[model samples]
Target: MPDARGSSGRPRRGDRKLSGDRAGAALKVLQITDLHLRDDARPLIGVNTEATLIEVLDQAFASFTPDVVLATGDIAHDATLPTYLRFLQIIEQYHHGPKLCVPGNHDLIGPMIAARLPIDPLRVGNWVFVGLDSHVDDEVGSQVSDRDIAELVAACPPIGEKRHTLVATHHPPLEVNCPWLDKDRIQNASDLLESLARQTTVKGLVFGHAHQAVEGQSNGIGLFGTPSTCFQFEPESERFAIGDEQPGYRWLHLYDDGRIDSAVERVACSFEIDLTQRD
Candidate 1:
């Protein structure tokens, strides 16, 4: 629909490189979400999510070589280990750098535990990536546990000369103003914001679950929500429905002097939408 390319066409060249003792290295971070991959080998919501993600990754690698990848969540359609393993295999093939993931509602926590996926908060380059588990057991809505809050609190770096922190989760901590999706948003979000408000190093929060691209600000921190790699949800809709928007991913550019800029790029794919299924 609208221009999926988030860039303004004018690339600014500064004296920052990906290495060395700068305020922070210039980082190209890719954010993709709402894959909803299933083990049944059938397309979800009339689109092949796994295939789309693979194509997206290929395009990303060819066009932009990112320093890190942040898969916000909804990596699987169901909580099956096969889905996770398959998704992991696809990621390993394309990405050679550090990749971080958070769990969505569809993820199986027990299987994730068994797989021994890294759950600790991590720091890469000049950015601190904090992964949180917000999936409630057998529930649609999300919540931040006491332990999750503690980990986020502990992950905060000291004020000056600290890495810019980006909190990654499956659910958005702020209301998206959509009826059906908002009902399933992260509960107790104010508490998380309260904890984040006190940290100067915490730069922003990025999430995926709404199946749409959204950007906003809260408590002076930037908030970004990525679109689904397979399908897009109608934005600001009162009911569940698919939008005509293209499937895409977000690319973030972190400058050396504590400046972060990001844009969404549409995937190169052709697919027909079946709107009748929404009824």
Candidate 2:
């Protein structure tokens, strides 16, 4: 909600191409998560993932052009090579900016890797965006591996280095109060939290898998959970229950002065889902 357009007012969708260093400019990042796409183009809980994704992308790009587009995860519901390729194709058709992905529990790393989506840390101005993989083998819950933690620690510049960092993962590191979904949060989140606490330059963490909007702080680091592109889970439900919230995405405004502003934007349309099929 902090003015992302700065004093110059909103940039025309193509006013100035954003990439590389803009040391004095505010960078816009569009985050779309839990795509839940499938090769068969099937619906999940009465919502068509592909259609909703396209709708969200169309609506988001119509509002503001982003320097970077981040997909937190669950890109594919079937984790198939074709699905991954299809997902990339759909996304490429929407926006030409940098596309970064993190794997969700439903994703297969091999296919995602084969698709060659960017997962490396990207730096724009003084900010560094790092995508962390928290996928656990054969498990719905997740954990940040020791190696990942070390790498993340190494990636953050020292306090006086003048570089701020933003980390993204598929699983939320903080509890969102939805007991059923909270159980699937990063199991070793304390390790992530403690490591982040020591790095003065680490600013925030963006993640998905909760299928709801969330904002919180832990150990001095900001935490954000974006809603799914498809149906959303009830934010405060104790068990598995779908909510009426429409499909949505999160917009992140990273300022040059180490300030971060973000807000969740929901699409205008809503889908009717079968409440009996709870999974």
Model 2 local distance difference test score: 0.80
Error (Å) of candidate 2 at residue 4 is 24
Candidate 1: tens digits of C-alpha lDDT, residues 224-244: 788888888887688887887
Please write out the lDDT profile of model 2 over residues 1-279, one tens digit for every residue: 111122344211111223545433678889999999988855677777889999999999898888888999898888888998888888888778777899999988998889887788888778888888988655788877888898888877767888888888999886777789878888788877788768658888899998888777676677778889998887678998888888899888888767777778888666679655333
Deviating ranges (above 4 Å) for candidate 2: 1-24, 275-279
Error of 2 at 127 (Å): 1.2
Clash number by candidate, in order = 0, 0
Model 1 CA deviation exceeding 4 Å by range: 1-25, 274-279
Pick by TM-score: which candidate is best?
Answer: 2
